[model samples]
Structures are given as structure tokens and as C-alpha cells.
Target: MMEPIPGESKKRVRAKPATKREMSQFHTDEYVDFLHRITPENAHQFSKEQSKYNVGDDCPIFDGLFEYCSISAGGSMEGAARLSRDKCDIAVNWAGGLHHAKKAEASGFCYVNDIVLGILELLRYHQRVLYIDIDVHHGDGVEEAFYTTDRVMTASFHKYGEFFPGTGEVRDNGIGKGKGYAVNVPLRDGITDENYRSIFQPVMTRIIDFYQPGAIVLQCGADSLSGDRLGSFNLSMRGHAACVQFIKSFNLPLLLLGGGGYTVKSVSRTWAYETGLAAGVELRGGKLLLAVWPKLTIGHAQ
Candidate 1:
């Protein structure tokens, strides 16, 4: 599980771990406390508390759980900060996009809703922020977090009813001031490049026209790619990167984040390809400077 390698010309910014106070921007104090207190020594007793926060099979309590959550959430926060400060036109956080964690609960292998926290950071500078989730499962937590806020518009494209944590429906648009802002494009199984584009392009165009957000956060979940262990879509590397390409065309302040992808090899390849796309590099005909199989190597290619 190596991260995507940035091009040699790109300046890499190291992310700092998110502190408890920083994470409290979106996560509840109690939930954050649980993540900090759970340890191998007290883990057996904590099992009884797991169900309260949806931390069982999907989100098991492992050692260094707090550190993992802090680092993952930290990357998204750093990306958002960079975008808000105009430090970078686009910031990529391959460790983030955990859209399934709620304000006080965990779900779908996500323990902290880093995307929400990241959006909050962007909101500090931008009047409006757009969150687009391309995970196979619905971005229920993120959609819910901004459901009543007009300043943040959330759009999720995912599999409908039969999927895990099923929630996204085309009819479930936002409420109150957020009405007409929450968009859902639920798809069937076996979606290919052409069909996905036919739907993605038009919907995204309409969203951009209507919302005109000052900043955009995209959750590029590799699980949607073909042969993903937990996904049903049939997208190839090119097909998956096409989504990133389309979004990058907007030329707005953008934050790219990683999401669901159980198949190790596919996830690494998809992210690496998309990273090249973000860096304005054409990796198609280039030779592999270093071979790591499931992971990518960081280096320059002629």
C-alpha cells in the first residue's frame, strides 16, 4: 500500500498529524476521545463500546488506531489549507477522503470524516465549496454533514439500494436552504467508460454551472475501477483517470482525495495514473523507472 508518486517537478509538502482540537471541527468530542483512548491494553473492554460508534467488523480497533486516524485526517486538512491559502491550485491527499464517518460514529471502514473536516477548512476562506464523491458506496456521512447548508453542495455517484451503507438516492436532495444542492446519481452494476462518461460529464457540467463553487473537493475512489474487490463498476485505469481529467479542466482550487479501493494492485495503479494526470504528465508511453508491482516508485522519467 504505497502512495502515489508525484512527478519530479512537483514540490512535495509533508502533512502534519491532526490534533484532537483540529479534528473536533467535524467529529464529536466523545467520538474523538474514543479514538484517542482505545489501546491494545484496553481494547478488550472497548469492544463493548464498539457498536455505539459502528466500530466492529468494518472499523476494527487496531493498535495505533488514533495515529492512523490523525494522519489520514491531517492530509486532507493540509490539502484544504493549501488550497485556501492559494498556495496551490490543486492539492492531492491520497490518504484522505474517508466520507463514511459521521459526526459521532464510524462506518464503512472510516473512523473519521476527513472530507468533512477538509471542507470546513475550505469554508474558512471560500464562500462556497463543492464536494463530489465517486466511491462505489454512497457518501452518506458527507452528504448528511452538509445537508442543510447552502454554502456546501454535495454530489455523490454510487450504486443504489443493494450497496453497503445504502443511502444516496436521486430523490434525496437537500433540505431547507440546501434544497436542490445535494445531487445523487445512483448507478447500476457493470457500468463502463462510455456509460459513465455519458452521465458524469453532463451532471458535472450542470453542477458547476449551477453551484459555481469557489473550491472543489473530489473523492476519487479507486474501488469504482474494474476488478475492485468491493466494487461493481467496470472502469479501466484510463476510464477512472478520465474523471480526474474532467475535473482538472475546471481549473478551480481543487483538493483531490483517496477513497475506497480494496483491491491493492488496482488502487495503486489507479492512483498513480491519476497522480500523473494531476501533475500534467503523460505516463502512457513512458517507461517504468522503478518497478514495485502493486506500488509506485518516486522518481523522474524521461
Candidate 2:
């Protein structure tokens, strides 16, 4: 397959690590300090702290733990900043979709909720921001963060029953001002591309029409694709990229983020292909990339 050259089509920029003040925007002070102070060398010392912050099994106390969290959150916030300043039409941060982190605790291998931080940054300039998650597991932390506000709307398509961090039910729409703002499409095992798009297109069309968001944050998790070690969906690479194509057709300020994907090879290929789609590069040489997916043109935002 012919691949697009990175420099010709897209530019890569290094993101500065997020500062304590910046991460404190969503995380509590105690939690942030706990993350900063604890390391693998001294993990046993902070037994109470570990349990308090849910950092044991999936989220272990490792070396450079705080640095990793800062970098991830920083990249996502920088992307949001670029969109807010009109510096780029679309920004892709593959390291910043750790959506399972909470204000005071970590879950599902995520120690910082970078998706929430990115949305918070976009909310500074945008009247409304729409977050779309295509990960196999529900984006529980992100939805909970914005569950009380209408400034951001979260739509997640994921496997629901007995899944890890199980939360995104169809009925669990947002509360108070955010009512009907949170959209969750619970799927079963082995959902195909056609079936996924059939629901994705119309639902997103209505969402864009009604919400008219100024910017969009899309979590393009590769685990939704077939052959994921931890996922049950049967979506192929083409099927997954189709979501990105449809969203890009809207022509809004877009921030693309990476989420959960256990299969390394599939994850790499999927992210690279989705990155090509975001950069408007036609990846040739595969029947999958041969225009089987339609280029949709939904109505412009008002």
C-alpha cells in the first residue's frame, strides 16, 4: 500500500508537558500531588494512597508515571488550543484519549482524563464541543465529567453488558442542563461496518444539526476493530476509518484522539489509516481504501 509522507501532508509538533495548574483544572489537588510524589520505588510506602487513587492492578505505580500523565494530557490540551486559536482545521493526538481517568482516581489504565482536559480547553473558545467515542468500552469517565453541563455533548458507541468500567447505557442521558446531550449507542458483539454506520450517520447528523458545536473531539479507539485482543466488535479497518471520514466531512475544527486498543499491529495500522483520512491523503493499493466508503457532506454548522 502507498502511504502518505508525513512532512508533505501533515506536520508533527512536540507538545510541552502539562503543568500542575493545568491538570488541576479537572483533577483534585490531593490526587495530582499523589500522582506526582508516588513512584515504583516508593509505591509500597503509599499503600493508602494507591488504594485511594485506584492505582494498583491496571494502573500500577511505575517510573515516570507523572511524566506520562502530563505528556498525554499536554498533547491533548495543545490540540484543543490549536483548534481554539484557528491554527489548524484538524489536530490528531494519538496519546491523549485516556478517557477512563477521574477527578480523584484512575481506572482502566488511564491516570489522567486527557479527553476531559481537551474538551475543557476547547470550551474556552467554543460555545459547544461534541465528543465522539468509538472505543469498544464505554467512555464512562468523560461522560460523567460533562454529565451536568450542555457546553459539551458526549456520544459513545461501545459494548455495554458486563464490559470493563461498564456504564454507558442508552437511558443514561445527561442530567439537568445536559439532558439528552449525552448519547450512548450500546452495541453487541460482532457488529459490522454497515450496521455501525447505519446507526452512526443518522444519529450524528441529528446531533450536529441540533447541537451545532463549534469543535469536535473524536476518540478513534482501535479496539473497536476486529481482532482486538480485548474487544468483541467485528469492525474492520475500513469500517473504523469510515467513521473518521464521515466526521471529517462536517469540516468542523476536529481533534482526533486514541483510546483503548490491545492488539498492537492492528492498532498501529488503524491509527495510521485514520491519520491519513484526517490529513486528506488517499491511501492507495488496498481494495479497502478504494472508495468503498462514501464521502458524506452533511449540512454546515449554523
Candidate 3:
């Protein structure tokens, strides 16, 4: 029941994070390169579970695992700092929505929980934080980290029972004092943008209005965008960015993070386009120099 004191954004659309292999505390250098090598064609040669975690079958491990992963974490951390410093209405770290990364393992293509890390940085100052994830997959990593803390509220709207990682059941709400703080709105399969909007707005309004946290962190994954190889939904980037606009409309200290997003073409385009929306600038799209990017900092977090 706390009122939010909105912080300032930097008033600039900063570039993505920089990943340095030397700085990470979570992963080992050998495994980082291992993830990159066992991808796609050679992926089939790996153990089934290894292929599950590697890049070949679905989540392709790329050359920049060290670079991209570190940079993504950096962006999310910066977003948390931006909100605390209060440079603009919203601070976005789209590269930090890597929900699949575990405490010591990488699964579902994610190397780190940038969103959780960003929120943790924010928690250094504020007592209440609201995390809203609108990705196709459940925000398992973020939700798990905050599942026992009332200080943060994680609201994820993702596919129903038995998705990847095989967690996030509706009954999996918060535990101990964190009860009801972890709200899971498991969505149906193959939902369109309209369905997304309908369910998203009301639930978000209800939760944010009731909890009244000091800040909001949104995971607006572009995997919800149509034609994504891994995604089942049919949303356009324009439709997806509407979520960013909605959160910003609250005028709170917000960090717009990114996650999911498989199709290279649509994924990059969608997040970049949404970044324009969060900044309150008109995106000229291949014409103007002011085209902002969206929620890939964690997912694309580059």
C-alpha cells in the first residue's frame, strides 16, 4: 500500500550493455564457450538434455555469449540505477529478460536473470517493487528468486501448465510472507494480440493499483510477436509496445526489460521499435535517427 515516487530517466536512449568475460560471477569461461560450440547441426550429437540447454535445436548459442550475456546484465543493472536516479519517466533495460537462466545453469537460451538482477539493484533503495512479465514463457527465474520476499511482487502472464522448464503453476504463488505477491496469470495457447491486450491491461491495473509499489519492472518479450520461430502467439511489435506505453502511462519509476524473442528479424525490429514508445519519442523507422529500441537488452540485450 505504498505510493510510488517516480524516478527520472536519463532522457536518452542508451545503447545495449557490454559483456566482459572477466566480470561475471555466475558462469565459468569454459562452459560459456561450450554453449557456443554445441549448437544446431552438432547439437544433435550432444546428450538430449545438453541439446535442451544448448543452442542447436531451439536456442542457438551464438559467438557473443560472453559479450551479449554480460552486456545484457549490464543494461539491466543500469536500468535499475536509472530508475533510482530519476532521469526520466521510465528506465528500460530490455536486454535483461532472460527468464530461463538458473542459479548455476543456463536453460531455455538464457544465460542470466538480468531482470531479477536489475530489480535486486533497485531493491537496494526501495522496499516495494512490482515485476510484470508478459512473455510467452513463464518468468520462472525471476519469479523463483522473489517467491519468498514480499519486498518484490512478480506478475507473469505466460502459457499454461507444463511449458518449458515445467514450472510456474497457478498455485505457485508466493510463499511465507510473500503470499499473493507472486501472481501467475497463466495464459492459453496461441493467444493473439487482442487477447494479450484484454488480459494484460486489467490484470496489470488491478495489481499495480492494489500493491502500489514504488517502482515497476516490465519484461516485454518480443517472442510474443507473430512469426517468431519459437513463439505461438500472433502479436505485432506495435501491439507489443502498447504494454510499454501502458506501464509508462502510470508515470512511475519503471524499467522496461526484454526477454524471449526468437525470430531475428521480428525480434530485433520489435524491441527497437518499442524502445521508441518507452522514451515518448516518435520512431521514424528507417527514416529518422530517433528510432528507439525495445525489450531485447536481456533477450537480445545487445
Candidate 4:
């Protein structure tokens, strides 16, 4: 869809696959080795290894699984590198933002956490980095990784109760020197555009003002849209993109990432629209579309 994006030929660069050493920055050596070694054909030989790494149903073993994880991580790491070097004001990586993968285990269909690697890259050059997650599920792995550090502040707005990988509670603030750095906005079902803005805008404003981050990493998960099969929020395309526009208004070096979005059409439209927003282009008109497709479903690509 972005093939003919204005000036994309000049702006885009092929993301190199992340090396095992690069992935090792945040992943355990045993886990990375297992990811690099295990394959579908050898599944019977590694039953214990699979069970140990939590790789059965949700995070299944497949061909090119390691390569897929590597490429995704590569795209995000490259985006962060570009931003840190001041080569681009905003870098968008729709292939990245797997926030559920821990250091040694996969969760919620995410095998590797590119968000953490990208943040670690940013922290090298920036004094402070702010991570904002708008996914329906909590970004638990990311919050856990930086929970003890004040250098990176994580703010998440997610569906709270009885969700997968549930950990983003409002009271689960950071500890020690990082106290009050982590912000979680646990929300209910079927929240509208106006209602979301009332909370999102003010909260983001306060966070930005207080944190004063050198860079921002935003996980624009389209599952928060109204018709998402795996999500319960009532936000429209405009409602979701509104978050992008507001964040862009900050004029900070931003790394835009993709997270959970199951509805195929909505996910495509939302990311394409948000990409346009990142490029300072308005890809849509005044009104936004809202229609739930019960039949169309893409399994956890985000």
C-alpha cells in the first residue's frame, strides 16, 4: 500500500536482519540460541525445550520463525538508530513493536521484543526515552524491563481486567529511583473517541511535560479501534490516528511502532493512515469509517 508513498523510494532503506549478538542485548543467550536452532521439523526432538520456553500454543514453532523475529527486531533497531543520529525526525516500523516477549520467554504470540531493543538503542544517545503503548493488552514485558530505571519512562493505555498478559494496573508504578516513571491507564470496554481523548490528551500532556524525554517510542496498536476482533475498545480510525497526530505535535524524534491489531482491513487502514500522519500527510478526509467484519481475521500479526 505504501509502495507509491510520496518520496518513499528516497526515504526508505532495507532493514538488515538483526544479528544474534544484537538480539542478545536484551534476550537470553539460551533463548536466542533456541530460537536460532529450533524448527518445525525438529519439534519432536525438543519437546522439553519448547515447554520450557513457553512455545506451544500461542508462540508456536515454525519455519523461518527466527528469521522473522530477527527482521522485525532489525527494522525497529534501525529506526531507533536513525532517530538517535538525527537522520530522521520520525521513523516508522510497522513490522516491529512486539512488546510481550520477555528476556527468556515468548508470550502472546510475540517471540522477540523489538520495542525493548529499540529503546535500549535510543538510551545510548538520548538522556531519557518515553515509551507509550496504546495496545489493548498490557505491554508487560517492556514495563518489566525498565521498571527499575528512570532513564526510560513507560506509559501504557490498555484494557485492564482479565486481558492476556495482564500487568498494567494503575497502581503498579515504578520503584526506587524510577518511582512514578511508569504510568498505566487501565480502561474498560467500548470507550468512544471523545471519551478516550478526555483522558489520553491530558495524561499524555502531563507525562511529556514532566518526563521531558529526548525521544518517544509510540506503540500505535490498531486493535484499540472499534471493530478489532481481539479488542473491545470503540475507537475509530480518526480516534486512533488522533493519538499519532497529538504525539507528532510534540516535535520530538519519534519511533512509531505497530502492536496488536487482528482485523485485517482496519489494521491496514489504520497503519497506512498513521504512516501518513508520520510523514506529515493527511491520507483521509473529514469522516472516518467504522464497520466490524466478523469473517475477516488475521491471526496476531501485530
Model 4 misplaced stretches (Cα beyond 4 Å): 1-5, 8-10, 285-302
**Model 3: per-residue Cα lDDT over 18-64, one tens digit each:** 34342243445555555545544565566664654454444555555
User: Tens digit of lDDT per residue, candidate 4, span 124-242?
Assistant: 99999999999888988899999998999999999979988878899999999889989999999999999999999999999999999999999988889998999999999999999
Candidate closer to the true structure by TM-score (higher is better), 1 or 3: 1
Alpha-carbon shift of residue 28 in model 4 (angstroms): 0.5
For candidate 3, the lDDT comes to 0.71
Report how far off residue 245 is in candidate 2 (Å): 0.6
Residues 1-302, candidate 2: write the lDDT tens digits. Answer: 12223344345657777888899999999999999999889888999999989999999888889998998998899888877887678888888799899999999999999999999999999999999999999998999999999999999999969999889999999999999999999999999999999999999999999999999999998899898999999999999999999999998999999999999999988887887777666676752342322221111100
* Predicted candidate 1 versus true structure: per-residue lDDT over 24-96, tens digit per residue: 9988898899999988788778776777888878788888899989988888888888778866777888888
Per-residue error for 200 in candidate 1, Å, reads 0.2
Give the clashing pairs for model 4.
none
Worst 10 residues of 1 by lDDT: 293-302
Error of 3 at 126 (Å): 1.1
**Which residue pairs in candidate 1 collide?**
none
Which stretches in model 3 have alpha-carbon errors above 4 Å?
Answer: 1-64, 284-302
lDDT for each of the candidates? 0.85, 0.87, 0.71, 0.86
